[model samples]
Target chain A: MSNKVIEISNLGKQYRLGQVGTTTLSDDFKRWWYAFRGKEDPFLIIGDTNDRTKKGSSDYVWALKDINFSVNKGEVIGIIGKNGAGKSTLLKILSRTTAPTMGEYKIKGRIASLLEVGTGFHPDLTGRENVFLNGAILGMTKAEIRNKFDEIVDFSGVERYIDTPVKRYSSGMYVRLAFAVAAHLEPEILIVDEVLAVGDAEFQKKCLGKMKDVSGNGRTVLFVSHNMSAVNSLCTRCVYLKNGTVYSIGDTAKIVETYLSNESNAESCKVWDPSVAPGDSVARIISARVTDDKGLTIDHMLRDQKVGIEFEYEVLQEGHWPIPNLHVFNGSEEYAFVSVENELEYLSKKGKYRSVVWIPADLLNDGRYVFGLALTTMKPNVNVHFYAENVLQVEVIEDISKRNTSYNQRLPGVVRPQLNWETTLLSD
Target chain B: MADMKTEPDEEHWDLVVKPKSSLFTLNLAEVWAYKDLIMLMVKRDFTAIYKQTVLGPLWMFVQPLFTTAIYTFTFSTSAKLSTDGIPPILFYIMGQTFWNYFADCLNKTSGTFISNSAVFGKVYFPRLVMPFSVVISSLIKLGLQILLLMAFYLYYYFTTDQLHPQWTLALLPAYLLILGVFSLSLGILFSSFTTKYRDFTFLLTFAVQLLMFASCVVFPVSMYSEKVQNILMYNPVVSCMEAIKYSLTGHGLFSWYYLSFVLLVTFIFLIISVVIFNRTEKSFMDSV
Candidate 1:
């Protein structure tokens, strides 16, 4: 039998741009008139591609247009996109919370979508009651919920408070109970959208583990989330959406790399006008740049080249002795390292100050890196003057010539530094 | 084309989502498959409303009892409305019991899309399950009110020779069945429109109040002229309510033609409402 459980083709959804009012009736009339005369919908041809940043002349926009992909049984597919790229819209259509305006899709077996957890949970209801209520809302039968009632309670770890109204439970406890019900849903095709954004770190880990277990049982899963690391670890394949259209669909690593690299535009130098620069009364970041040792501002460099992050800031108020810090993050948003300069010999008059930190050659992995700049004071209390999260982004490319090994492939670890080694051959 | 060879039977696919969904798609089987959900929703609606209350479920009896008392006080002596020789308290309670159920069902089910939009937006089930559960939950409330009515009913039957419950009392379930069908269908239809437009909500609240006066809730149909009676019987709720009153007190109008007319209208409205409701559920998320 064919393993492809879901087949979507040429799917699209068109939405009106503004508030529904007088224009809706006219549009409806126009649509009716066209249909009556055996013509096409007049507005269908006039929609702009959905790009929330830009204002378009047309009153209609295609939130998703011409989307086509198929998922085989047991394959975990991650849908990643920038906000308003139709990620949620696609999931809504796939889960049938909404219908597409164009094309069709066929699916085999049951599909359960958890676009949100605890959708129908009543605050006055006890956690035990909410488990059954939420499970039913997610399409579990009473028998199934009954069968897994104990297990769900055990998984949520709120058994002591099961009979207590969820209103009294902490938000963490509530989400745990809700996700517990969702995690126990054994559907053939599960479509999840960012339910892991809640809960503590440990709970999130448990949820991800449960999702992995779900997919391991020969079921198809569609996951849509902004957490790149979660998508990287959980999904085997990915579909990257840009401006409401499929940009690429392939192996998770390649698609995620394309998504992350394309997302930030990889700026090496960012300069701001002093008046509008990001800062408090203490200090303001004037400019930030990433450069190679040759002093050329660079957005990409070979792994063997030393990388320098330069920040220029003005201290508006002086006596506090401000410290400049650089926080480095890899492509998956995991912090590689944070470097803080705490040595300032004396507190002096306010003026422009520049700080630069050099990352050693071959010390970082060959992936996109983001630099965050912060000016802080450590006096009686620690206070951040300003922190620019994504001041500069640089891609470190692999240098094939530096390695003599037969394997010319990417190595594991956040930093792939070349360390001095002594190999004493023991009678091999 | 390749699918035709690889999967010869398209029926092998469990679901086929299409742009042009058919209008008459009422998946009774799908609704049946979600029976547990429907029952759970019913329980949620039933139990959740009474939570954190002093009276709890006892409040169910309070509303109808007070309404019956108010109706008897206002319309019994002051308005001197005819009840066809049945005592005013029993008459008012009988009508109030059935009317409250019908109105409660309509009122709750009619707000299914609006009231449950938070839950509806995030999950996918047969949207019909919402209104179906509303009807069932209101039936449970009605069940409680019926017991209250029976208390007054038995007292009147014992004391007054005028009280005579006909053998048609056996058809009480049938009357309630018609009532459920009418309210469920009409409520579902109203809910479909209420999803997009706010006007229907105001109109429905106003219309339901007006509907009670039009139906034989507080007064009997016998008090009206032939023409007005003919017009009143056209309301499916009128026939169902009068049939219930007749089965209980044995004096209200119970015509076979009118009952069947109620059935027919209920049947037609059920089909249209389910179709419109199905279509509404598809894209209501956008407008809602």
Candidate 2:
């Protein structure tokens, strides 16, 4: 049987950005008046296509525009994009949670969307009741949930709390129960958002295993997540979105490489103007930059080259001995290391101060990594004044041309330790 | 989830989503497929109301019983409202029981978009199921409350020579169906409207109270002036509530002509509300 599940074409969703708390009654009147004329909506003409970098000219913006892709049955497709790149919007449209503003998509077979772990879980309900309730919400029949009832409870490992209300369960237990019910869903087409990075690490492994079991059954899956490593392992294909449009779509590895390299290339250096300095009056991050030893702004550096992160901040208060810190997370969003300067000598005064931290050569793995900075007063009162997450990103790619060994592949880990190896022949 | 068993036509697409969706696409199959979910929602709404309460489901019976006493005191005693030879307690309990069913459906379904926005945004189900569940659960409550009305009914039937039931009681099933659908239609219409503008929520509570008076729930339609009766006749709910009274007591016109007119109006109202609801379901998450 030739198996194909989904075919989407020219899909788009436009949103009107404003103070949505209360729209004037006149706007409703205008919309009705224009809708009656059989003309294109009067507001649609004023919509600027969604490009977050550019200052939009109108209140209307397309959350997803002209998105086109097709999935053969059993293909696990990963969708990766930046915060505003419309990944969620595309998933919403495909899952039928929300409709596209334009164009169409043809879908075969039943589709169930696990957009979040517990989309419809009622906290007051018992865990067992929530299992049935959530399963039914995800398009499962009562018999299906009943048959999988024990398996779901066993998978969640919350048997003791089965009869207790979900609200009484800890947050981790709540996620496990919610995810257990979600895992029992066996729809032909499954659409999942970034709900996998929850619970303990072991449950996440079980979830990934369950997803693998799903696609192994020749079921099509659409997964959206910012976790690149998870996508790299689970997806055969990938769709990269940029500003509400498809930037690229193809092999998972190639598309991921393209998304990471292109994304970091544009964000190697970040500057916060005085108007938009993202901090309270206590302190403000002026600039954060990733550079090489030669002081050149670099998106790509040799695996052995020293990487430098320089963060300049303007402190506007005294008695605040601020500790500037950096947290490095690898491409998979795992925290590689955190380096905070806690030297007791420097009492931070009201002035522009810059802190530069350098990483030794060959210390980090040959992969993409991002920087997060925080300014906190950790003395009498440990209060975090400001923290800038993902201030800069860099890629430490292996130089293939300079390889000597037969195997010239990058190793996988948070860091690559280059320790001296002593190999003396024992019985020469 | 049920399997889609048709042969895979690689060239043929199953659904085409366009900017202008077909307005009348009810997709009853999709709704039916989610029937289990509808039942759970109804169960949840029914039980969730009485959870941790002292009286539990007894509150359902007690509410209408107490309201009957209050209404008899206010409308029958002070205002001297006539009950057409039926005793005041039995009359008011009957009116309140039936009107509560309609009012509950309208109140709950009207807030469907706002209240369920959290679940609705994260997942996709036939949005009609929410209001449909409201109607079903309200029917369940109505069934429970009807027992209290029945007690009064049986008391009045044996003791009082005034009670006279008509053969139109056979039409009670059809009347309830009309009443349920009419409430669903209006509730869904208001639900769709409240998604964008919240002004209707406040208006709805007041409007339902006004609707009860307009339907002649507390007073006989014949007691009104001719011009007022003409206006009340145009309200489909008047036909619905009056038909119920006529069925039980056989005191007024049990006219099939008026009942059919009410059904037609309800059918039209249902279609219009469904259109508005379908459109809102697609993009209400954006504005809601």
Candidate 3:
């Protein structure tokens, strides 16, 4: 016999995206008629897969399309995607929470899913009762549950509140108990969604440890999350989805790299026009660009090189306001730094000002970053001018050979600028 | 390291390890396997009903007793309905006890999909377990109410010295069987519909109350005209209530042919309900 626990072939799921009314009824009839006659659905031909993110003319969207993969026994796979990328839909289909519109899958083991916490818990029932209820819902027999009941309660750390109704428990306590029952049930296959997004950091660590132990016991797991670091640490393989189709599948590091790079490339900056940007009082941002020191257009830059942003705008009136602000964001769309021209003080005498903001050499660390600019009235609590988002792109590079930084300083966060450091042996 | 390289054995496990067909078959063995869960659900429903209440389980007896008293006073004396030589209290209590079982089953079962959508959306089990648990839970209430009816029956039997009570009481099990079939089928059927059109949920309680009067819960079916009786017999619940009343006091007449007709109709309804429930379980979360 084969060791594969799940074999899926050409799995597809389509959904109608609109209010359920007469129009949908007629369309459903049409689709059902074609399906009855063993013909391809006529509506599926409207939009190509290349532009799935764009709103289509039809009211239907395929949530998953032609997905094919196989999972061997004991393999833990992480599924990653942005919002509306069909990651949840794929998990739902595999869990049998919903059926696919087309294709098939063969699952060779008992599957338990922790899609959400407190799923099977009744508000009026005690925590002790909910454990058994949730376990049975996951297909565990009473004797099997009885054998692990103490372990579940212990892992949950809610022993004192075991007989108290879950309704009174805090969300953290509830999730801890719920996840404990799910992970301890010992199913042959486990599916978990982003339920770890709840609970405290310490609880998240505990849940992750339990998941690792579960996968270590020769059971298969399919995990879906947006946390790249956790995915890197937990999964043996990774699948990246984009607009309901498998974009790539391979090793976790390679797949994450491909997904992140592709995401940045797909969001290529668009030219700005005053009419397209929304604002009330002040002048709007007409255009913005990033360039090298030689004034040549550049998308990527070295970590220790100079970078410049040129802002072009048309002033609505001669005003003492219109403070231009620049914000820089790291690859994950987190704001890295904000610089305001309010300190220039020279711009207070300007009319229809155009200027460039420059960063000197040897400042940023290695990473991709996007730049945004806004032209707003300097006064507080007032609606003003226009803002342009993700207008300029910059990339920083690192020399892999250099290894002087301490371990604590290597992690990525909101700040990546180098700072002066000195050490002295004072009393020795 | 050698133990780590060895593949885990799959044969020793009792879990269903084969690929399931999209069309699920009723696994009677699986239900047998999860019987403890069914028992737990039943216990939860029974004990939790009056958990925070002052009277606790005593309220179970009090509810049926008060309903029977009001029903005897209103239907027997005020409406002047004939009890067919049986005491009014015994006649009404018999009908009310059986009818409540049917109503409880229907009301609870109809809300099965909506009520358990959270659990169903998260995990996979025999979805049939939920509706089946409702039937089992309602049976507990039925058993309690029947015990109260027995208490009233003994009091009437000893003090009034009612004749012909022994023979009719022997048919009580058959009456309960018929009632069980009727309620289970109706509950599953309504549950399937309510999963789609939630408007039916609001109408369910009022529908049950209106159905109680038409099924002879408070009055005898013989009190109505023959035309009304014919119309009432078309309702499966009417046969169940009439069967229970006839079996308890030996008052109303019994018809095996009509009871068989009710059984056949109920069988067809149960088949339809199971089929719809199976299909709905696959995709109901989309609408819910």
Index of the highest-lDDT prediction: 1
Error of 3 at B170 (Å): 4.5
Interface RMSD for each predicted structure: 2.3, 4.5, 6.0
Higher-DockQ candidate of 1 and 2? 1
Q: After aligning candidate 2 to the native by TM-score, how far in Å is the CA of A73 from where it should be?
A: 1.6
- Per-residue CA lDDT of model 2 for B30-87, tens digit only, reads 8998999999998888666676799889988888888888989998999998887889
Q: Residue A260 of candidate 1: its Cα lDDT?
A: 85
Give the poorly placed runs of model 1, Cα more than 4 Å off: A21-23, A273-276, A279-284, A313-321, A342-353, A377-386, A400-409, A416-428, B1-11
Predictions' DockQ, in order: 0.64, 0.45, 0.36
Write one digit per residue (lDDT tens) for candidate 3, span A112-163: 7878877767778899888887777777877888899999999999999999
True lDDT of residue A333, candidate 2:
71
Candidate 3 per-residue lDDT over residues B1-288, each given as its tens digit: 244249653533223222224454656676777777787778778766766789888887887789878987787878888887778888877777788788888888888878888777777667777777888877878887888888888888888855355365576666666677677777776777777667788788798889888887776788888888877887777876676666666667566777778878887777776777777777777776
Candidate 2 yields a Cα-based lDDT of 0.85
Model 2 docking tier (incorrect/acceptable/medium/high): acceptable
Model 2 misses residue A17 by how many Å? 1.9
- Give Cα-based local distance difference scores for all models: 0.88, 0.85, 0.75
State candidate 1's DockQ.
0.64
Residue B238 miss distance in model 3 (angstroms): 2.8
Ranking by lDDT: 1, 2, 3
Residue range A18-111, candidate 2, lDDT tens digits? 8662234676678788889967667655677677889987777888888877889999999999999998888888877777777888888888
